[model samples]
Target: MQLVLEKRAERSGTIALVSPLLAIGLTIVTMVILFAILGKNPLLALHAYFIAPLTDGYSLQEIAVKATPLVMIAIGLSLCYLANAWNIGAEGQFLIGAVAGSWIAVRTQGTDAGAWVLPAMLVLAAAAGALYALIPAICKVKFGASEILTSLMLVYVADLFLDYLVRGPWRDPHGFNFPTTAEFDPVATVPLLIEGGRLHLGSIIALLVVAAAAILLARTIKGFEIRVVGAAPRAARFGGFNANQLIILTFAVSGALAGLAGIIEVAGPVGHLQPGISPGYGFTAIIVAFLGRLNPVGILIAGLFLALTFIGGEQAQIAMKIPLDVTKVFQGILLFYVLACDSLILYRFKLVSSNRQVPRGAG
Candidate 1:
C-alpha cells in the first residue's frame, strides 16, 4: 500500500510538470485528425497552420503585431489571476479604452500636438479601462454580485455603445458614411520601430511590461500579498490583507494594461477606430495567460505562440482552403485538453484489486 501510494504521488508530480506539454501535443494530434476528416492531408495542413508563417520576415513582423495586444492583456490578467480576482470584462475594458483613446485622437486631428498626443491618448485609454473595470469589481465587493456574469454582459453593452457613437455623433463626415472615425494624424500614431517595417513601439512596451510584471510578482510586497490572498483568503485576512482593496487594485491594474493594449492596437496597426476594431484579442489573452501558467515570462512565450497561430491560420485559409472556423476549433481543443490535463495534477485514478477482501465482509 505504501509503495503504491508513493508511486501515485510521483506520477502525479510528473503529470503536473508535463500537463502543458501533453495538452499541446494532444492539440496537434486532434488538429491532424480534424484535417483528415475534412479531406486535407493532415501533415500538410499542420505545416501550413504552424510552420509556414515563421519562414519569412514579413510574417515574423506580423506575429509581433498580433502578439502585442495579447501580451499586454495577458500581463494584466496574470496579476488578476494571481490575486484571485476574476475580471472577465477585459473585452469591455479594451473597447472602452479604444473609444477613450480615439476620442482624444479625433479631437486633436487638426492640431500640431505631435508626440504628446499619442502619450495622452494612451493615458486616457488606460484610465478609461480601469474606470470601466472598477464597476464590476465594486459591484462584486459591495453587493455580492457574480462578477463573471456581470463582466461578460458588460462587453456587449460597451461594444454596442461604441457602435452607437461611431454611427452617430463620432461619425466622420468625410468618411462617406463609413462607420469609422477619421484617419488619425500621423503624429498621433505609434511610431514604427524598424524602417520599412510594420513593427511598432507597442512590442517594446509589451516586453517592458512583461519584465516589470516579473519583477513585481517575484520581488514586491504586494505580490506576496496577492499570492497569499489567492492561495488562502482566510490566511490573508489573518495577516491583515484587505480583500476589498486587493480586489480593486487587481481589477484596476488588469484593466489598465488591457486598455493600454487597446490604445496601442488602434494607434499602431488598425490606425483608426472602426466598428469592429478588435478581433477578440481580449478573449484570446485569457488563453494565453492560462497557457503561460499565469506567469509573466511564461505569458510572453505563450502570446507569441498564439500569435503565430493567428497568422498561420490566416495563411492556411488563403493557401490551403481551410475554413477560418478551423482556427477557433483548434484553440478550443487546446484549451479543453490543457484543462483536462491539469486535472490529473490533483486527482488520480485507481484500479481496484479484485482479489482483495472487502472490509464490509469482516465488519
Candidate 2:
C-alpha cells in the first residue's frame, strides 16, 4: 500500500477559507480531551475558556485591549507573508520599539515635554522597529542567510537587552529596587478612549491599521506586487519585480508595525517600559496572520478571537486551576492544524494499493 499527496491543478479557495475554522474546531476538541485527562469537567472548562470571557463589560474591554497589538502586528506580518518574505523576528522589533520609545519617555520624565512627546515616541519606535527588522532582511539579501533563523534568534537578544535596561540603566531608583522604569508621564502615554476605561487610542489605531491594510491590499499597485511576488515568483520576476527589494520593503513594513504595537502596549496598558511588557504578542500575531488567511479584515477578526483566548486562559487558571501553559499548548496545536489544513488547499491525499509480487510468480 502506498499513500501520496498530489498537487491539484488549481488551488481550492474553499479550503483556504475553511482551514482556520477547521483548525479552531480541532483545537477545541483537543482541549476538551485535555481537560478530561486533567480530571476537570470538560464542559465547564470550555465554558470558562470561551463563554465566560464575553459575559461582562470588563472582560470585553480587556479583550479589545489585548487585540489591539495582535491586530496591529498581524497586519504588518500579513504584508511580509504576502510578499514571500518571512519576518519571524517581529518579537525583537517589538522590544526594540518599546526600548526606543521609552528612551524619550525616560528623558522627558518630570519635564513638561508637551503633547509632542507621545507622537515622537511612536515615530521613534516605528523607525527603530524598521531598522531592527532590516537587519535580517539585509543579511538575507546580501549574504544568503536564512531569515527564519536570524529573526528568531534576535528575539532572545532583544529580550536580554530589555532585561538589562530595566535592571540597570532604566531602573526606577525609588521603585523599591524593582527592575522597571518609572511610569510614563501623561504626555508620553496613550490617551484612553473612555475616562477610566481600558479602551484607549491604541484600539482606534489598530482599527485604522486594519482599514488602511484592507485598502492597500485591495487597491494599490504595491499591494499587487506583493501578491504577485508571493504567489508566482517567476512571473513577478518576468514582470520586472525585484524579489530582494520586495523582501526588504516587506520586512521593514512588518518591523515598523511590530514596533508601533510594542510602544502602544507600553504607553497604553503597561504604563512603563518593563521586561515583561508583552505576553508574546509578537509571536501570537503569527497565528493571527495565518488564522486570518493573511487578509487584513480577516486579521482583525482573528485578533479578537485570539485575544479571547488570552482572557479565557486567565479565567480558566483561576476558576478551574488549569495551568497557564495550556494556552500556549492550545495555540501550538491550533497552528499545527492550521498549517496541516492549508495543505489541502494545494494538494489531496490518496491511498494506492500495491500489487503483491507473488501474484506475478504464482497466482
Candidate 3:
C-alpha cells in the first residue's frame, strides 16, 4: 500500500480556526516531555514559560517592546504570502534597513539636526528595504530564478555588510572597541510613550501598521487581486491580474515594512546601530506570520504570544537554570507542529494499492 496526502474537497471552517490553537497545544505537550528529560519539573517549567512573564508590569512592557518589530515584520510577510511571493530574506532586509537609517543618525550625530532627521531615517530605511527586496523579485521575473533561494541567499550578504559597517566605518570611537555606532541624537530617536518606561512610539506605530494592513486586506481592490493571485492563478489571469506585478509589489511592500521595523528597533529600543540589532526578529516573524494564519489581526496576536516566549525564556534561564536555546527549540517545535496541523486540516491521508496496470505506451 502507498500512503498519500490528498487535498480535501472542502476544508472545515471550524478546523481552520482551531488549527493554530491545536498546534500550540501539541507544542506545549512536546516541551513538557523535553523538560522532563532535562531533569526539570515540567509543571514548574510550563509556569515559568507562560505564566510568570505576564505577572509584572515591566515584563508586560518588554513584551510589547519585543512585539513591535515582530508584528510589523510579520504583517509584511503576510502580504508576500497572500500574493504567492516567497520572500525568505526579510532578515537581510531588516539589517539593511537598520543600516540605511543609521547612516542618517551616524552622520547627524552631535549636530544640530532638527526634527527632520528621524523622519528622514525612516523614509530612507523603508526605501532602501523596498529596493533591496526588488532585487530578488526582478530576478525572479526576468531570469526565472527561484525567489526562495535568491532571497534566502541575500540574507548572508546583508549580514556581512552590516558587520563590516559596524566594525569598520561606523564604529563608535568612544565605545571601548564595541562594534556599534554611537547613540542616536535625541532628534533621531523614537520618543518614549511614558516617562521612564520601556514602551515607545514604535509600539504605537506597530499598532498603526496592523490597522492599516487590516484596511488594505479587507477594503481595497489591491487586496482582492492579491487573494485572487494566490488562491487561483488561472482565475487571476482571466480577471486581468498580472501575477508578476503582484509578486514585485508584495515583495517591495514586505521589504519596506521590515525596514521600518528595523529602524524603529534601533532608534527606539536599541538606541544605536549594531551587528546584532535583531535577535532573529526577521526569522522569528515568519513563525508569527504563519501562526497568525497570514491575517493582520492574527499576526498581532501571534507576535505578542511569541514575544512572551522571549521574556519567559530569559526568566527560565535565570530562575531555573534552563538553557536559553530552549526558547528557540520551543519556537521551532511550534512552527513544525503548526505546519503539520495545517496540513492535516487541508488534506487527508489515503492508502491505496501500489500495483496498478500501466496504460499502453505509458512508461
Candidate 4:
C-alpha cells in the first residue's frame, strides 16, 4: 500500500478553525495509551496533568506567571512566522537578553541605584536580544545561509556562554559554590502583583505585548506587508513588499520580545542569573506560536494552556513518579500532532495499492 497526501480542491474553513482542537484531542488519546503501557492509571495521569493545576488559586497564579514568558516569546515568533522568517533560535535570544539585562543588575549589585536600574536592564536586554537575533538574519540575507541551522547552532553558543558566566566570573561568592550570580537586588526586581503571590508585573507586560501585536497586525501597513510576503510571495513582490527586509524586521522584533521575556523571567521569579535560566522556553514557544495559529489573542490562550502542562507535569512527577522528561516528550508529541492535523487542512492522505500497474499511454 502507498499513502499519498492529495491536495484538497478547496480549503475547509471549519477544519482550519478546528485543527488545533483535533490535534489536542488526538494527543490526549495517545497519552492515554502511553499511560497504560507504563502501568499507570490514565485517568489519574490526566487529572494530574489537566485538573490538578487548576484546583487552587496559587497554582492558577503560578500558571499566569509561567505563561508570561511563553506568551511574550510566542508573540514575537508569530510575527517572524507570519513574515516567512523562521527564527528557531529564540532560546538563544532569550539567554542573550537575560545575560545583557543581568549585566546591569550585576554591576549595580550593592549600589544605591535609583529607580532607573530596572528600566535600564529591560531596555538593554531587548536591545541585546535584537542584535543577537540579527546575526542569523544578516547571514541569511548576505550569503543565503540557512537561517534554521544558523539560528539553531547559535542556541548552544548562547547556552555555553551563559554557563561559563554563571560558573566562573559571575559565581556567587557565598552561594555555597553554586553556579549563579547573586540574587538581583530588590530595586532591580519585577514587582509582585499581589503582596506575596507568585504573579508579578511580567504577566501585565505580556498582556500589553499581546495588545500591541494585535494592533500592529490589524491596523498597520507593515502588518499587511508581512502577511502578504508570507502568504503570497509573488504578489508581495508585485505590490512592492520587500521579503528580505521583512525577514530582518520580523527577526529583530521576535528577538526583542524573547529578550524582554528573558529579563522579566530573571527579575521576577528566579531573581538571579543562573546556568539553567530557561526550561526550553524558546523552543516551546514555537509550539505555542503554531498552536495559536500565529494570532496574538490565540497565542495568549495557547501560552496559558502550555503553561498548565509545565505545572501539571511537575505535579505528576511528584505524585506518580513520572519522569520530568515525560513533559518534553508530551510537548514533542503535541507539536507533531498539531502539524499533522494542520496538514490535513490543505491536503489529505490517500492510499493506493502498490501492485497497481501504470496505464498505457499515460505519458
Query: In model 3, what is the error at residue 10, expressed in angstroms?
Result: 1.2
Question: What are the per-residue Cα lDDT tens digits for candidate 4 across 153-260?
Answer: 999999999999999999899999999999999989999999989999999999999999999999999999999999999999999998999999999999999999
Off by over 4 Å in 2: 1-3, 356-363
Give stretches of model 3 more than 4 Å off: 1-6, 349-363
TM-score of each: 0.93, 0.96, 0.95, 0.96
lDDT against the true structure, each candidate: 0.88, 0.94, 0.94, 0.94
Which lDDT tens digits does candidate 1 get at residues 32-132?
99999999999988889889989999999999999999999988988888888888888889999999998989998888777789999999999999999
Clashing pairs in 3: none
Off by over 4 Å in 4: 1-4, 349-363
Task: TM-score for candidate 3, please give it.
Answer: 0.95
Q: For residues 1-363, could you state the per-residue lDDT of candidate 2 as single tens digits?
A: 888899999999999888889999999999999999989999999999999999998899999999999999999999999999899889999999999999999999999779999999999999999999999999999999999999999999999999999999999999999999999999999999889889999999999999999988899988999999999999999999999999999999899999999999999999998888998999999999998999998999999999999999999999999999988988888888888999999999988776646545564
For model 4, how many clashes? 0
User: Candidate 3 at 62: error in angstroms?
Assistant: 0.5
Which ten contiguous residues of candidate 2 have the minimum total lDDT?
Answer: 354-363
Error of 3 at 328 (Å): 1.1
Clashes of 2: 0
